[model samples]
Structures are given as structure tokens and as C-alpha cells.
Target: MPDSSAERPRRIVARREGPMLVEGPVEIVLEDGTTVSSDRFCVALCTCRRSRIFPWCDTSHRRHSPAARPAADH
Candidate 1:
């Protein structure tokens, strides 16, 4: 039998240029009093303030960089 207290610790990671990564099975309470939850093994919390899916990372952080964009067709 395994000890429940010996379970691995949850982790949260912050990036200098991207979203914050958090261990999942998380719930968040928004400013509007709405609640959101995710059960993913890892969840990415938006930090760039550019996600259409606010509170979640939708790769919106990459959109802000000119190098990440494709050149326009003439």
C-alpha cells in the first residue's frame, strides 16, 4: 500500500515571455464571480493579456511578435 501523503507535489511555472504553467485539476473564480475549471494534466494560464480565451493560453502571446508573423503577399 502507498501512502497518500507521499504523493508528488503539484507544480506551477512562470515564464518570462509566455503563460504560467500549472498542474491541473484546478478551479478559478473570476472577477465576475464566475467559476472555471480544468482537468488537464497541465494547464497554461494566460499572461500576455491577449487571449481570446481569457484565463487560458491560446498562443496569443506569439501573435504579438513580428518575427512570428508571416510576410504579406504583395
Candidate 2:
């Protein structure tokens, strides 16, 4: 339990157009004071506020503009 990795702080990766990644197990406190927890190895946090699950990325940001995508080649 005295490992150096254990002494290190949690790592978080942020992206402009995507979710922010954080090393888990994490507990998130929402605006209303409710707390949510996730025990997954990695967690994706919503940045664009488009997540159906809010605070947790449901990839809703990716669906922001379906029409903006180029038409598929035949």
C-alpha cells in the first residue's frame, strides 16, 4: 500500500470537443449537492453539457450536429 503510484494524484485528460477522462474510482458532486460515484477504471466527464446522464459522458456531444457530417461515399 506504500507504492509510489498510490501516492500520485489522480490524472485527468481534457479535450475541447469531447469528454474529459479521469482515472477512477471517482465520486462526483453535482450542483444540487447530490453525489454520484463510478468505479470504472476510466471515466469520461461531459464538458459540452450534452450528456443525458450529465456529469458522465453519454457521447451526446458527438451527436450535436448530425447534418454537419459529410455524406457517406457509395
Candidate 3:
């Protein structure tokens, strides 16, 4: 069994084929110099680059494919 207490809290969870989940203290900056900062404990960042939210994930990958989840490799 895995130890729950040993689990490390991730500041960000970037999916392989899907949106990236960011647990805040995260700062998102756009290419046009616009930025969105979040104090929330969790957020989804778009990996497919098709989200209307831009740097944020809006679960748009689900429309592209069913395997919509982040992976550990870049």
C-alpha cells in the first residue's frame, strides 16, 4: 500500500494528452502580455492549445479524444 502522508503536493499537474491541472499559487501569462493569477487550490491548464481560456484548460481535449488525462513525461 502507498502511504498517503508520503504523497507530495503538486503545484501543477500537466497532462500528456489533455489539460494541465494547476494547483495554485499558479500564475498564467499569455503571449500578448496579459496574465491571469489564481489563488484557488486547483485549476486546469490547456495542453491542446485550443481552450478559449488560452493558458487555462477548459477540458477541450475531451472533444478531440477520449484519453483526456495528463501524463508524467514531456
TM-score quality measure for candidate 2: 0.78
Task: Give me the overall lDDT of model 3.
Answer: 0.72
Model 3: pairs clashing at backbone N, Cα or C within 3 Å: 15-70, 16-70, 16-71, 44-57, 45-57, 46-56, 46-57
Please report how far candidate 2 places residue 66 from its true position, in Å.
8.9
Which tens-of-lDDT digit does each residue in 1-74 have in candidate 1? 23538877669898887899998777878889999999888999998879999899999889786768899999
RMSD (Cα, Å) for all candidates, in order, is 5.0, 4.6, 10.7
Can you write out model 3's per-residue Cα lDDT over 1-74, one digit (the tens) per residue?
23537867656665568877766666667789987887777878777888887777777778777555465596
Q: Stretches of candidate 1 above 4 Å error?
A: 1-9, 66-74
Candidate 2 displacement at residue 27 in angstroms: 0.7
Winning model by TM-score: 2
Q: Poorest 10 consecutive residues of model 1 by lDDT?
A: 1-10
lDDT score, candidate 1, position 6: 86
The local distance difference test score of each candidate is: 0.86, 0.86, 0.72
**Candidate 2 residue-wise lDDT at 10:** 83
